[model samples]
Target: MIWIIIEFLFPALLIALPLTLYKSNRPLMTKFYLRMTASGSARKLYARCMLILILLYHYVYAGGHFGEWGILASTTFCAILFSFRRADRWLTRLHEERKIFFLTAVLVLTTCAVPHLHTVAVTLAFLLLAAMFYPSRNVLSKWTDEENRIRWMNNPKIVSEYYY
Candidate 1:
């Protein structure tokens, strides 16, 4: 009975938590989108293509054999690679701070993929979900700084010339 409930709940939470976080972080995501757009069209197109490829690989090729853990690891690996190449200094800094979180998430997801570690995985996932809502002070400060920068960029005088 409890096992059955947990089996259902774990997958549901895995899907729901990320979606909730994405929705809640819309403003920040929007700012990221704007910054990406401002970077250049070629890079934007490359990013979109890479995203499509990764999704296709995950769903069509890797999903049945390796499950969600494969995607988590691959995505984290990609992010670590991309962080160094990002055009924005602030984004690079943010990614640097998140490297530890990304590593831990990968570790947890890998553990979750193991056959006999279900309980531990569930606990880690819950803890990680909680942590997502309450980021470290450095991350919070950086986010605040980015918001202020965006606000400054949107000033009447600056918006006319720079902002799209």
Candidate 2:
């Protein structure tokens, strides 16, 4: 339980920071992410953290059959694909690009299909991480106004939400 929460810190902070601080780097960072992604942002600091965490879970934690491990392993790709193409993009893109999902499913299914499932499971876990990652922005962008203010916080006051 504690590990789950601890592992969630980066993802949570990525969402919470802007929402609480009401900062919108949409314009600049849109270009920045493109540049970064082009320059290999998919393998950046946070992405590495998530990958390492997944590897830790599989090698140090699950260390066994694919079923118990692959589902959790694939979530990184699920999240990347989910964010890159909005979850709404599922119908449009999933059928075409969902090979990653199927690959995860297959590796997980191979528990009964293969021997020494742990090695295959770990291999698939790392392969799953290689697909891609895209962080969702604008969890707070919609709340920012023309003056770059958090319109919801009337009086232009800095409230306790800042520390949140």
Candidate 3:
């Protein structure tokens, strides 16, 4: 029970950090996250801590063919991916690209929450999701110029909800 509470509370606390510290702007949140993790060592430390915490949780709660190894592998792969500039660009894009990445990441997390899915399926989904971000860096760099910014700002639908 304590572990479960910690598991829930830890993420909530982390989420609350940026929300409380920043305005309700999506771009600000992205920038805040990037700044917080600007250091490669800091990022690695965070990933290592997450890996330890998650593995401990899985070992205690998920018994018998629950695919703990697959989960670990996916986490490891994601940590490795985070080391690349491409991953950072994909994650921190200041435009619609970031929204797409955010949506895809949320979807992946949602799907990964299904306890009934085989571990292998979950692992494959995670890998595919990670791979999906690979091409966006180049594409977004090309699209993030001032002309595109002007076009994006001119959109009526986007102007009202300008935070995202």
Candidate 4:
């Protein structure tokens, strides 16, 4: 059933994207989290609290992104989190260029609380594309000057050379 595609399967694949992409580095992520926590700074503690709230929202909905209420709540949480990260001078330009697509995806996910297969697929597809797009996102883009941007653009494309 197309319902199956838009229901559990799409979300399952969404879960899988981070699983696969972060597979090699989950231990490192844990380690980094631990290391950051040890400092016990107020900001860090607040961030941890927000992370917990995000989890609470996830749990409260039985982790259902397809339900309307869940989508609104989850998208709110995500937008808050993304704003905090992407507002940094270091994170700004990296997101500003493609902001339309990113915001569109967020809007799609936010409205997807009902089980319309076509709509859900579009939402899921946006998420899938975003998941794949993010890991390769240029973190250093904000630090570059126009000359650097041009110089970097001038080089012939090399996919294999670019990715580890």
Candidate 5:
């Protein structure tokens, strides 16, 4: 069971982190990528493609755990899609925030209570946390005066400024 979780998680991290990092620090990452040789880019791209292909292969083709794999893929896809939304409305949308917070709290508590399903619970908690934090992340990026680095932090927005 643990190995199953690890197999899913490792591929997810590979796919998610690079994309997030490139979004968060585009100029620097772009420059870095540009400096790499063509062969290097090919190798890196191939590796990432292969990782995703292999993981999806397991999800679609592997036997004996089809239901769990399907659930994992669906939830992961939804989480990734939802992560693109701006969470700035969390301030004025107090009712919505309350519901989200309550659900996240429940997941966290459930993770503590159920050792057998720890990995699934933890993954869900992380997805919820990302949804909560994504919109406010770029707030600090605009505020920072420093060069060569970008800061990210959560600072809620006004009602009119909120993302609808």
Candidate 6:
């Protein structure tokens, strides 16, 4: 009984550590977020790589079946296609928020789908989920303001040299 309880609570405890840290240290997290978002292309590349890794994990460890391979291939192809698109220029705040929400949902679903949940698997899933959802309400507001300022400063009609 004790082992079962520990198995279930371990991941939750691991996830809580980061949440508490972020909650207690707002400025530090904001700075981290700014540094992360400074290079837009780098952010996209990191996200794509993480997604591919997650899919690969699902394919390899979860089950090496034909169905899993097909799902992995199709999802990877779609991810590649989306990455190549020039849609980043047109993304609004609302669109970005929706994408974040979608990613969170996907992560949750993927974690829940593991056939045999083990300690390591649960730990990895929770860590990934926590990292993905790190931005708190205060940090997000600051991020939005920073993004808007950058967009305003970088407007083609404003000037040639960048302000920020």
Q: Which candidate has the highest TM-score of all?
A: 3
The residue ranges of model 6 lying beyond 4 angstroms of the native Cα positions read 1-31, 62-164
Count: clashes, candidate 4: 3
Q: Which ten residues in a row have the lowest lDDT in candidate 2?
A: 155-164
TM-score of each: 0.37, 0.29, 0.40, 0.29, 0.31, 0.37
lDDT (C-alpha, whole model) for all candidates = 0.46, 0.40, 0.43, 0.40, 0.40, 0.43
Q: 1-164, model 2: which lDDT tens digit per residue?
A: 65555544533443464454333334443443333323333425444554565545444434233355444534555355334324324322322366855867576567526543443454343433333233222312323434434342342232222211
* Candidate 5 displacement at residue 96 in angstroms: 11
Across 1-164, the per-residue lDDT of candidate 3 in tens digits comes to: 76567545534543465456433345554443333323455434544444454444344435434545455644465456445454444434523365665665565577557654323234333333333322233334433566645554454233223333
Which 10 consecutive residues of model 5 have the lowest summed lDDT? Answer: 151-160
For 1-164, candidate 1 gives per-residue lDDT tens digits of 54455456555766786686442435564454344334445334544444444444444433244444445655554454344244233233333456855776787788778854543454445434433432233433443466645664464233212222
Please give, for residues 73-150, the per-residue lDDT of candidate 4 as tens digits: 444544654443432322223324467546655666665544533333344343334433232234233214565444
Index of the highest-lDDT prediction: 1
lDDT of 6 by residue, 113-151 (tens): 764333234434543443443333343354457665476
> Which residue pairs in candidate 6 have backbone atoms (N, alpha carbon, C) closer than 3 angstroms, thus clashing?
none
Q: List, residue by residue over 13-94, the lDDT tens digit for candidate 5.
A: 5457645753433555443322221133442443344335444534433443544444455345434433212222332232
Query: Looking at model 3, which ten-residue stretch has the lowest summed lDDT?
Result: 127-136
Model 4: runs farther than 4 Å from truth? 1-7, 22-96, 114-118, 121-164
Model 2 TM-score, all chains together: 0.29
- How does candidate 4 fare on TM-score? 0.29
